[model samples]
Target: MAAPKPGHRRVLAAPIGLALTVSLAFLPGTASAAPQNVALQTSDGPQLSYVVNTKADAATIERVKKAAATAGGTIVVAYEKIGVLVVHSANTNFPQQMRTIKGVQSAGATRTAPLQAAVTTEIGAPEYLAGSPAATATDVPGAEPLEADQWDLRAIGADRAAKINPGSSNVTVAVIDTGVDDTHPDLAPNFSKSQSANCVGGVADTSEGAWRPYDPASDYHGTHVAGSIAAARNGIGISGVAPGVKISAIKVSDPETSLFYPESVVCAFMFAADHGVEITNNSYYIDPWLYNCLDDPDQKAIVDAVNRASLYAQSKGTLHVASAGNANHNLAAASITDDTSPDDTAPVVRTINPRECWDIPAQLPGIVTVSATGVQNIKSYYSNYGRNVVDVAAPGGDKYQIPDTPSKNGRILSTMPNNGYAFLQGTSMAGPHAAGVAALLKSTHPAATPEMLQELLKEQADNPGCPTGLYDPDGNGVADSVCEGPKPVNGFYGFGIVNALDAVTAP
Candidate 1:
């Protein structure tokens, strides 16, 4: 989610759920270095966002209001049901001060980022056709012009799944991402107008086109994700995995393309829960720290706030699906390196244990963590792998590793911003495939629970043993990363590639 600028201010690469990946450093005067009883950090200016957790009651809410006043912090949006409050503060020590208030369960600066984050991400240089036009042809009922190019559809057996069940129009899958281009021809047919809203500044805005993507650099991500899940089978462009479902654009990313923050993320899930959303596709991680350690009080509050929001959504029957991430490190490993912290500012390098520090929402409880695979049914070079963490695999594309074909560009293609289509690759791209399958399952069995869908996903996966030896697809004559686990289930493939066909046909 980090913006692509260098020097003075570092990158704000919030690639948790996008195809964009860039390394950056943390800056000063950010939330991660929350100071005590002070408004300004010696290094940076006054600008901060914090999340406060308290008991769910009126008395605690009053105290929370008073505490915010004393600390020069203002409430952005407070989730009374879950006891989570999004606050804007100039006081660097606001979090430290808030902890002293009675009835406060936890308090922490949500992100190590400033109020107005600046970030830019590249989706990839897609292979645009010679005469691709922004205006798509009239709709009919068959394969779209680009349907043959969608290898991801066949890879997950979505074609077979469609034969079993084309899904129901009643089911809506929310794209909790940068934003979705609801106006795209392929998406407009199945777009749920009432379910779309912008949670950009930590508050839900339901104005017309409020959830539409505007930033040219990163907005394409959410749109691409929506198409992958439910682009209509109108015989024009491409077909989504579950073309019979509807898509909701829940915008959470900011204007500068900064990463999704805890406040926005919380609001997104809550909104989905309240509006009857059946499933959510999360391709990005909450910004700033890629791994929030539980030991740190500030980081703990962030994790707690988000966990509460997601849990509440699940309680309301919404399935939260998250991407495993593009980093190639083994999450199942005992330890890992995270050099990017407070990425909104300047970052500091650090090493940590996975059990204590988590790549949130993905590693968070109840989330269905998805891994990425290329056209060849092998793990994508950049996808993170874990025996205990990853739940399933799907086609996210691999430019260098997979075999080439005009249609198989080794990248997933879907609706771009202007009613057009383009390619992108990442674990960010894989989660939606699973979400689409889950939507089909939900459509086929509306009475099913999240637990039921999760079990069905793993059960239907086509299990294959781990590739023997060093699995390096780049052919650099060196091992890229080693595969772990066994057949039927493994660290890289997680139960094996997702089988959408079995999901709808299962008895």
Candidate 2:
């Protein structure tokens, strides 16, 4: 499938009257309450996942168990209505049979997969570029400087007051994406102390001794994303959003092929959540095949699991930041209605009528859904927006002009894969930038809860594209009026482009 293109459009449709419901099965298991922290039931039982479709009942449970048994495994979790079952394979050979079982559906490796071999061909390391040591280093050839770097570190400052702080040693941010180039001089110093299993699969080669716990694959997406968050700022290459921060690389997606299963992604999340990591950044979005409300039961189950894991992370005081999605249509407005029309799977293209909304994961209550903005202080042409859905916007590079070009402003610069640098334009890139900013805030304000961190980020946001007075035409105060011209908290630029300095300094 082609990569999802970026663009935002108003979604005009009726509200989804159905409320998200959860069903209780067996007494809440350890995994159920803390989906992301999966403690092996017996140290031998397959890892448990707490996220299950509560709508599933006893009958559904029996059906899933029977299917798993036939496939030579046991059902760890059963999600009836959503059609998802977490099965632990007693043996590895039954993987194929497990897929064939009636309700078994797709399966992921119960054990960790190895990373792909690293590139044998040696390439000269790029010249290191010096950046301001006081703030985040922005050395990308054409990348714009972050306005937020000027402020004191929010989370870090808070931590200092409490006397419990992350001095270079305790702060770690996990970049769960394609994979990282451990050998990259710019990223090597900050690699985690111990490596973990690759949820995706295969062993990664570390020819230059920079190998960490992440799996290796052709995909450079994870590596690039990692660089942006915590690439080493040792006076070489470009600096990261949080230069003082360390990086934990977890390869969940293949950047080269963009091929990744939902199960692998979930496992990666669980791994990060269980381990003592401060934050996890996810740049990927939901697949169209699985986004349908009435799609395959297993697909729905996986989506539910992802949400569960996210909640679990939050309960641990660890934030799980995800991309709002590239689709321009309002997620709430777009849904799988009972209509049997032929074009049901077709993309939703309609203008939002007065007083309607749609969005996903972003719409998911607790998750932080970030939007994108360009240099001109306007919303990125590809950014999706809804007054209530998008929590905030950050600098996503613009395609119209060269980096630093007077008229062609708004592109954010950070490290790219292969020791090279390029201005990536998309919410995918924008989300991480904000995540990095959040990491910085978290470092400063150790006592701030995830909710508090989010609130501070919004309150300190610089309003743009709207008037100074109440711009919310909807009266909800959630959706600001676009007519007032973009302001810090207006619809076009949620809370105004992220002001790193203000976020850190705000009391």
Candidate 3:
């Protein structure tokens, strides 16, 4: 991700679709327990960041800013247009104190992590090391020599998709995750440096390479996802799903601390909307509160802040595409246990009413949600599914679940920092494919609104009927998960895996 010039990197350092009529969250795996490294999860004690929404009018905004100041918080950034103010406070009571202010519509700590938590590993990282090392250089006729190994691309027929339309540079898909390596040769050809910015600190920084991985060795998530969306049509590396579109990065997740808090996310959306981003691929979940409950004031405020930014982005013509998570649970269920909230702090397991609670941005309105499938076109073993949720599906690979050839590793391959490529599984990898397809659709139909795109996404999916009864892929005499809905649109493979070919050629 590109950071704003130094001045814009202000360190708050915090942190779809699927018009399936239902919703879900985006992320690779579940955080069922507290992190082992307490210090890295929390900063000095419990410094927290918050987004306070109020009336957009100057008087009300001033009142809100004034209230935050009085509440022992510093204004990191104040988005007057959305009437949202990002503030940081070490005071544990800052949220409650601000809520009592007259002009404040909602206020809450975005994360339980202490301010300035050190970034660490992303959600249960899977090893992508192949028999051979990824090379910095590449060959032509098909990008990288490993092109033959990218079964995920062929599985979804992206090569064929490109033949039909190849997409358009006018459309930009922002990878709002860790950070994208703009210099990666595979990505450079299509990277939109002007649109890339670092939003790691509750603000956008436009510095040179400001949006790059904090630690190239560890934070390759965004780059991988970005490559999947728009790597390049160049003869060097592998081509992306929509190699013609441009890519932008909004760095929100921190590699040192493995955190993606609220303030940073709110900022990312605003940046995407303010810029010319037409689509955004969100492959990570908003942490600190995995499932925010509307009844809980603190959680509600966090959700409200993000929803406001997302809605604003939508109004500006950005179609948000998110992963359906790798939790392997039924998102449409009435109740589920969330043992991880405030992931920065000790987590306590609590059951939640799915209908009453939500995984922000994913569950948020107007997003085009995407699920994952494997070689057999069956749901990825770990992907979350629900009849009311999951709008579409794409190739995300399944190492232990779905069997496949050419890529027996059973994971998706995309660009990595330092001009490399790696295999990665999980919905985290799945979302990019959907984002790429969305980009192609936007390019083909420039006049299509976010709503129109959402409809077309589902309309283009090649449906695969749900798995037999319990979906016991392991055959351990126990069911994996249940799929609810009928044909073309069901729980497992929502609308079926994404059809890039249809996306480009379909009328």
Weakest ten-residue segment in model 2 by summed lDDT: 118-127
TM-score of 3: 0.87
Candidate topping TM-score = 1
In angstroms, give how far residue 39 of model 1 lies from its true place: 16
lDDT (CA) per prediction: 0.76, 0.47, 0.74
Higher-scoring candidate on lDDT, 1 or 3: 1
Q: Write the per-residue lDDT of candidate 2 for residues 1-507, one digit (tens) a residue.
A: 234322222222122211222311221111122232222222133332212243245664575466456545655444343444555555444443333333332333422222223110001122222444234435543223432321112212221221232224456777766666766766778877354336542223223323232333235456666666665546554556666677877665443334444445555556666677777766665332313222223333444545455555666776766565544433333332212111113444434321222222334335566666555445555555655456666665545323343223334444545454434556666676677767767877777777887777677666665444553323475632232224544455555556555544555
Model 1, CA-based lDDT: 0.76
Model 1: per-residue lDDT, tens digit, 1-507?
442111000011124312111100121112332233434222224768898887778887777877777788888888988888888888877877777666676788876657664122222455454445333442333556676677888888887777668789999999998788888888999999799899977789999999987774446778888989998877657888999999999998877645777888889999999999999998887777778776787887877788788878888999988888876878877688887676767888888777667776787666788888888888888888888677888887888755454555788887888766888888878889989999998998899888788888888888667887678878888888777778877888777788878878877
| Residue 344 lDDT in candidate 1 | 69
**Model 3, range 142-187, lDDT digits (tens) per residue?**
4455666667778878887887788999999999888988998888
Segments in model 2 whose C-alpha atoms lie over 4 Å from true places = 5-67, 71-169, 193-197, 201-218, 254-257, 288-290, 294-299, 330-363, 401-410, 466-489
* Model 1: worst 10 consecutive residues (lDDT sum): 4-13
Candidate with maximal lDDT: 1
TM-score of 2: 0.63
